[model samples]
Target chain A: MPENMTHVPYYPGCTLKSKALGYERSAMDCARSLGFEMHEIEKWNCCGASFPLTKDNLMGLTAPTNILIETEQHCKERDIDAKLITLCSFCYNTLKRTDFAFREEPGKLKTLNEFLNREYKGNVTVIHYLEYLRDVIGFDNLSKMVKTDLSHLRVAPYYGCLLLKPQKELGLDDPEEPVILHDFLDALGCQVIDFPGQVDCCGAYLIMRNPDKVLELSHNILEEASEYGAQTIVTACPLCQSNLDQSEAVRGEMPILYFTQLLAVALGLETEQHQFESHCIDPKSLISSCKKFKEFSDAK
Target chain B: MQINTENNQAAIRDLEIATGETISDCYQCGKCTAGCPASMDPSPSLLIHLLKLGLFTKAVNSASIWDCMACLTCSERCPKNVSPAAIIEGLKRIHLNNMEPEINLNSLGQEFLAHSTQQAVVSGFRKFV
Candidate 1:
């Protein structure tokens, strides 16, 4: 609560509040460590989880638009910049794309605003927390803050689909060959691995309808990461984490973690903040092993 | 496989309106199919081809529509920017509007429901239901 500390409006979405508490907790803690406060938007609703694919589905745009309006008000009340940070990749994509849609079609914005009895000037810039780290806080500064040596752990940065698809809209990174996760992980002192399944789909929402196909897809991603000698896999999407973590075929073989959790660890935050137990495949042992090796080598 | 030009034209027009992508822009480059990880049969290119050939019914009937994960790899790889992924989603919207949801929430086992993330359940209902 220092006077000069930056205040960033945040949207936790549905998953972060319910299933992805670890992702939320770690991200907030890391933001504080990095000298920024993530202010949650009061009375924010769901970002609809998935962006409505149909061009005519303005009804689907309402949920995220409401969240954006709330973010704008949240920033206004605090006298901060109109930037809303999202943790969940799905929420990031939905809110970002919703903002993009309104920008593309001002008429649609007018229709939605009039219908909802609210005015959103499209002033809010929706960004993922990773973007904030890379853009706002340079990786150089982040590397300087790393208190733990994670060089012993080889991590795979999984982009999945939401973070980098439909490049025209999201444009977070190269949808084909992304390096933000690599750069972020590198700054954390971990060895980053480049794997094929990094940007591939982990069967996404298909898990609900076709769990078998999801298993096959998630298994393929895990196998590829394992083949690349990755000791752990880090992702930005809650659904991707769940699908990859719940792969019955390779359960407990590879621990799938949110990128923020690893950031919390590298920042030397309290263990409870990472919420390791919430993960389907607990990464506590893997993380502890890495720490133990660091200690053992230091002792040598 | 009788090709009904009328229905095909209507379907194509509907899809263009829904997705805002020109169907004729696709030239069957196969890059979308090659890059797809979902193992979609009657691949994305083939579905676009079917629409071009006035085989709207066949394209709509293909089970591959459901198999699409909406990863947007095909859409991103398309040289013509046809966004076959969006087209497939448009097809899904059309299909869903006409039929009952294929997934029954009650039929899902308790364990699966318990472990699935809220994002999955919400997005699952959005896409499947």
Candidate 2:
């Protein structure tokens, strides 16, 4: 399993490249430290977080389908058999659901492909970063690659809404009580805290118009995490991270860290620490105080 | 509260066709309303009830329609498999279609628009438009 990954295909959904650059950087660095190279698709576009739920909304499928088509073509040209891994949960859900639509409704896929004047056989398999860690990379190798054990940090793993929903199909972990993140954190030598708000919505896309409501939801989540005695909240979705971190309600008391940021810390990967400057609730102070930081320093 | 079943028949049919969920099967169990994280006044169950009763106009303008985060928790928790989020999306789409001519792209101020991250603008327009 250790040698399974040499060069892998990565899909940096729009938010990752723009708003969540820290997540993308940390994830790529961590992957390299674990003996893998993450090669992003040469040309990519946004996987509109707003997936068209209606039957006739073919236009809504274009951006995601185009990304899939391009990624598949790249893989084909290179003869690489890698699954397209996504950093954003929103992108993961949209791309995965689009792929599902192509598989389940071949007629729609054919029609869309024809409309775009391109034929995609739906060859690309899309996955979230967490799945890449749990299934593809394997936790044993992950633990072995950790240069600094983070057993002293207590983290609340938030799954948000998209990662696990429409439970019957998505092939994501259990929608009700997913433990994939908890297990991943445990393997990274962190004490994972369980909270009810772990799977609650951060009111995605509502942050603009309904700041009050988004703040209320964010407050509820952070309140639960704080009550559970979690020093920080770790999440997979970029929007979720931004929403939770940017909410003024928390007043900079809680630090929201992307799951990969913690991975970067545990692996002692040298990264630009200023990547955290954009976070509303600063994670630098809490992250620097972790037991791993001491171990990292002693080793240095 | 007025039921305009005769006038809104086409709207109801369009909703059913669009969402692909059986709106009439909801027996008012309130599971969707109960499980929704962002559920507020004019709850998800009430929105579905408006659809079931053929009150498209009321359903379309309901604040709860926008309040729905489209989390799909209600869809998973529904006993009869009624997807409230999908139904809300359909309602929003209907509203958008009715306002299509007036939805001038230039009318959306650039400065006001710039405040939102790409996630919001893309998701907001994708669902509504």
Candidate 3:
């Protein structure tokens, strides 16, 4: 396993390990197929999604700070400073903001390291898998490796906050008009459709406190996608998927899929390897439809 | 000045220092309110207006503070960079610190926990508690 020698340390946050199994499986498989290998850290913990905007709160910083310390140690053992890959957008956002706090603010970093009993600086860089794909793997190369062209599919790319917000440290693209997912989906041979609700908040976590708000937000997104002729909405955040994927209004409107799942399917991985079973709306119909298209195209 | 009014003034002063953003900087532009996705009753601008006037009671009483999704849309579009999202968070902290509302952890498990990630529950506790 030559890839193992240079394996990049991967952090699978709580959601990916439990609820988003397919996201993890498909992301790893797709990364491997693209010539990048992800090695999960032996010890990792959840990065609380909502980063405390309060400057005086040290307790809020503990969880993400400890995860960074562990990741630093993981990279040290491998003698590699490769970036830590995160599969979930919320995790990516939380970790990235915390990491920035450590690097930019010396006073906070000193106090956090002292509390954690580790002499760690901001050594390990945290990046979302989308960044890994776009920056590291190169979308053009990714496009060339497609086994089943997804040209017949129309996908709405939902960024659902976090990936680009606060505009201070975590902004990955033009917050008003991001095209990272647009180019990525197009490269995979899928027609990317433009929708206004693509960047709207999914009323994240409000599904608990305010279910109606979440339903309204999720329904708006699904309705917009359906109106635009999108078959499924692809997203990078597990929270966004959970909120939008299986709501009563969105259940049959359109299937919500992790971008990695789509990549794994396009890379010609067996259906069993991806966890389409966990999805509420059932993406198997969409996958089978693509398979039928592949078979029909191959026959000609 | 009445003792209660003095305390309210102190609270606003402390909040300004804590958030490192002066309410005076807001200038009643309403840009934050216009861009806010969660904008509704007691709009972001309205909350800021009350906060600038040192009306902590009215600001905290409004349910809109809790409704802020922390999407930062207002922050991104704010002409003065006045983060209504951060202000709302500060208001929640003040509420939690004052009211000492019993954040029944059990209440979190009602129905949403089943669908939510552990990260969300943990973060929600960290922010609210």
Instruction: Find the candidate with the highest lDDT and give its number.
Output: 1
- Write one digit per residue (lDDT tens) for candidate 2, span A34-62: 77778999988888786777767888899
lDDT on C-alpha atoms for all candidate structures = 0.86, 0.81, 0.79
| TM match of model 3 to true structure | 0.93
**Model 2 TM-score on a 0 to 1 scale:** 0.92
Candidates' chain A TM-scores = 0.95, 0.94, 0.93
| Residue-level lDDT tens digits of model 1 in B1-129 | 122335678778988898888889888989999998888899999999998987888887788888888888898898997888888888887757765575887898898788778888888888878
- Clashing residue pair totals per candidate (backbone < 3 A): 0, 0, 0
Query: lDDT value for candidate 3?
Result: 0.79
Would you list the clashing residue pairs of candidate 1?
A: none
lDDT tens readout by residue for model 1, A1-300: 346668888899888987888888889888888999988888888788889877888889999999989988888887888999998888999999999999999999999999999999899999999999999999999998887779889999999999987789988999989999999999999999999878988999998888889998889889889889999999999888888988933654778989999988887777686678977688888877655235534755
**Model 3, A1-300: lDDT tens per residue?**
235434778999888888898899999888777777889888877777678776666677888888888888888887888478898877888888888887788889899888888866688788888887898888998888787868889999999888888657876787889999998998899999889989998878655467678778888788888889899999998888888875634446578999999988887776686788888887888887775346645765
**TM-score of candidate 1 chain B vs. the reference:** 0.91
lDDT head-to-head 1 vs 3, winner? 1
lDDT by residue (B14-54, candidate 2, tens digit) is 77888888889899999888888886679999988887887
For model 2, report DockQ. Answer: 0.64
Instruction: Tell me, by DockQ, which candidate is best.
Output: 1
